[model samples]
Target: MEASPILIAIDFGTAFSSYCISVNSGHDTSKKTERYETETVILFNENQEFEKFGVEALTAYTKMTSSEASRYYFFQNFKMELYNQKITENLMISTMDSKQLPALKVFSESLRYLKDHALKALSETVAESLVLPQDVTWVLTVPAIWDNAAKDFMRQAAQKAGLIQDILSENLILALEPEAASVWCKQLPTSGFIEEQAGILDKSTVQQQAGVQYVVVDCGGGTVDITVHEVLDDGSLKELQKASGGGWGGFSVDSKFTAFLRQIFGPVLWEIYKNEHPAELQKMMHTFSIQKCTEKEDIYIECPHNLAKLAAKNKDISSYFSQLEGACWTDGNIKISYEKLASFFTESIKNILEKIKEILDTPEISIDFILLVGGYASSSLLREAVKREFGSRYKILCPYESQLAVAKGAVIFGTDSKIIHSRVSALTYGINMSRKYDPLLHDPKKRRVNKAGDYTYCTGLFLNLVSKGQSVEHDEDAQYTFFPVDDDQTEAGFRFFSTEKLNAIYIDEPGLKEIGSFVLPMPDIRLGTNREIHLKIKFGLTEIKANAIDTSSGEVQKIKLKFMSE
Candidate 1:
């Protein structure tokens, strides 16, 4: 008999990435059903040849020389690039050595590493006879606030990484990070390990009671995603507020600390240190990362001798450090005070708090609890700051292994996606098409003579399919039918646009952005211009899916919309 279905969830994060695997037994109450294991992939060098991954990668990177390390690509905190702008096919990431690498290539490599590591780990833990690639269902966790283009980009990279044989296969799933965390937390009662670690005897205590609302704040390395959910009597979750967030996350704190170093060392010396002493800088940054997670009055970062020597020669650089406040150099190490360290977190923390407040201030949503999850959510400093800001007004709950919540929750989501019944549309999605000219609605100047000499308004009227802020059921498809405008037309093109306005008149309207286009090849023109094509679009899922069906030829085509600009 085939073994039970194994679900694997890959959390491709900004600074750290990890995977969790779970085997689901047929029985609903079986303890075996909740057993899941996770492994974190580490990035490091291997024998100065190829980069190693997982724990081995971390070790190898540490042992490499400065020059060797510079040549090696260690991608951490790289996922933020996807959210930096309107993601396109040409987006690239710059490595520490100033080499430009395609973002998709980097993401695929990371996925490949995670897949190989997970397989090797499974082979060692479970009998090799029981595990097979086909038996596994892969779930990739993504930030809920990411655009359709970014999500599609991840799907493509996952395909390139060999995680999924086909993107449309049910075996592969994309679980929104915040939704996954909410589901995982709700189902923690079945998990033996997570419940114990979280010190919760009854996992239902974390579940929002009927009529109560809660907000999940996913504070990952690169982005902070906030969403509000309402609990129904049947224990189902309904998204009360649309997902929203910014780049104010843990990496922002790290970036501020780096900026502080640049201030003390001066730009010229800092550039020298970054290029010439990358290994030392890496080590220092790693130390800082560890320290930031723990509570401390002050932290010391060791300065390289070469940096000190250069600093001594430059009077301006030497004076800069001497006059710096809340920091001092002694014994070749710079001591940063707790006050100064906390300043690094203030900006990001404030941004997150403001977003939370904005959500809570929404007219009808009454959030009772704020659930914190993700890697940055595990930071004591961040935790304390959050509690200090809104602890009295709202209950803040940070479960154990908050960093792994998204990945572990993703595994549960792969088993059942109905945990989140509905989600609010973030934007209005529609298509532009020509319509019959009406004197009452159409401007006379917009009317044009068609092939048959009939006056028709070809000025791209937007047909709204999904309106912004509208509640849509999960996996629900909105269908619309269109007919060919010309009798001999061999192809039909649909231009899709998303905007914040409920009624966008045209593609050129302000605040309207074209997300993608769907092209359908028509059948024989003998069917005539009245041939109807059914276009289906779904907006509730993580990515918008479009399909076109030629009713005349009985040909159904799955439209893979291209997000990049030509």
Candidate 2:
């Protein structure tokens, strides 16, 4: 391997995962392989230790007998559990069998498996030299809509996996999944994308031109993350609006399919079968998953032998399915009508299209292109839905191998972090503080008196640092000055709050939420109330960073906000 730094990007998606390796600036093409991604599935032994990952795990579990499989744990689609939820260091996640295990253990062990696999691949590619952990820069992809707590949880998981020694090490970078996709899409010409308009002659990177704007709709397996970007004058990218999305993704369609099966098999029998024959259920879903992504025509899924045996106890299996709509039983396979199959994607496609319209509806924001990326973007059903709704107004483009875009672009972002110049603030951030009570502006009920009874202060005041919808650059920071309310106070606590409101007034407002907090030590009380503490908060990156300096002792304290614990 070359002495130059090597970059490895890991796209840990909900349904599937993939990684890419690059030496210096280009890919390390020492070996040729057709597979670009694998199932995000893991299997653990009876002792709760990691056994297999990805395809191997799926295969091992599928081969095991029902009795033998019950002793072990199989987990898939576990990544989505961290989204839109309160995360803690000791959070526990349940396996498909409803077995409990630490979330940290599951995530860290999975990451460790990927790390070792990548290193092994690199070693075989270059026998002349060995690659060390320090020689490679790691990039992890995460959804842009994830909160600070979720992002922090991923960093801690990476550290626990031995990817880096320190939590704040520069060697590990968290690349927003949509942003990574944007970076890779910008380097391609119009012809590189799928379903381009007819007779388009300009072949250069049309979206790369200065002032060109586009919307990145990352329809992953778990969630769809949408963001608007514009090319800066210098060719870098800038976010036009904050990322907005929902739980609408490819998995939603899968859920509908599961429901449809339940309808055919009767809810009581289906529930009982799910509890008794989980392995068979998993196998059936796995088959449906592959067919849903492809197969535009009628789809046939083989019914598990156990499920068929159980259904026969009540009545003829063929007679049972005949009563169902758009389903037929023939040759031991259940055939699904194409119209009924397309209906599975109705909710996801509707939500995605509506979100894109909402973002483009912003005043002064004219989008020239719409880019679809991620694993779900490969679905022919979703492609047609997006094109039908906005194809006439904007150039809808999906790059070749759209699923690999995030992983490959993450490698490029790891090499150069300045490709994204700015980002839009998703929420208003501020610190909860108390100031001198103002009779005119402060509510009398909120007024408080100190122990000394000499000063009157108002509690629950929200000191705004950054407002929602504000454009912030990576280097730009919001600074504020604070002082102790009591002359003899030896420490101060900083509480961080966020809300969707553009300008919040109080910390206890209806929509505001206290995310994390940390206490800063003020060992020196000699300066009394005159001591000045400077707090600086930096945003626009994958995670928020905060630090404070005490002018009296010239001490700098790095802040890692603590979230709610279990």
Candidate 2 local Cα displacement, residue 386, angstroms: 1.3
- Angstrom error at residue 417, model 2: 2.3
lDDT of 2: 0.85
For residues 1-566, write the lDDT of model 1, one tens digit per residue: 23237767888888677787666633132333232322233353433233665446655665667777776766566788888477777787775556566777777877887777676677677545656566688888999998878888998888888877877656678899999888766655434222233333334555545776889999988899988888777777889878999898888999999999888877988898787766566667778887876586888888766677778786743366667898987677788999999899989998998998898888887877688898898788787777888877876777787887788777767776766788999889888888888888876776766677644655678889989999998779899888887788788888888898987776777898887786788867887777999988777766677789988887788877766653
Each prediction's Cα lDDT score?
A: 0.76, 0.85
Residue 513's lDDT within candidate 1 is 85
RMSD of each: 3.8, 2.9
Q: Provide backbone clash counts, one per model.
A: 1, 0
**Which portions of model 2 miss their true places by more than 4 Å?**
1-4, 25-36, 126-130, 198-203, 444-456
lDDT of 2 by residue, 479-505 (tens): 999988888887888899988888777
What is the Å distance of residue 227 in model 1 from its true position? 0.7
Estimate the TM-score for candidate 2: 0.93
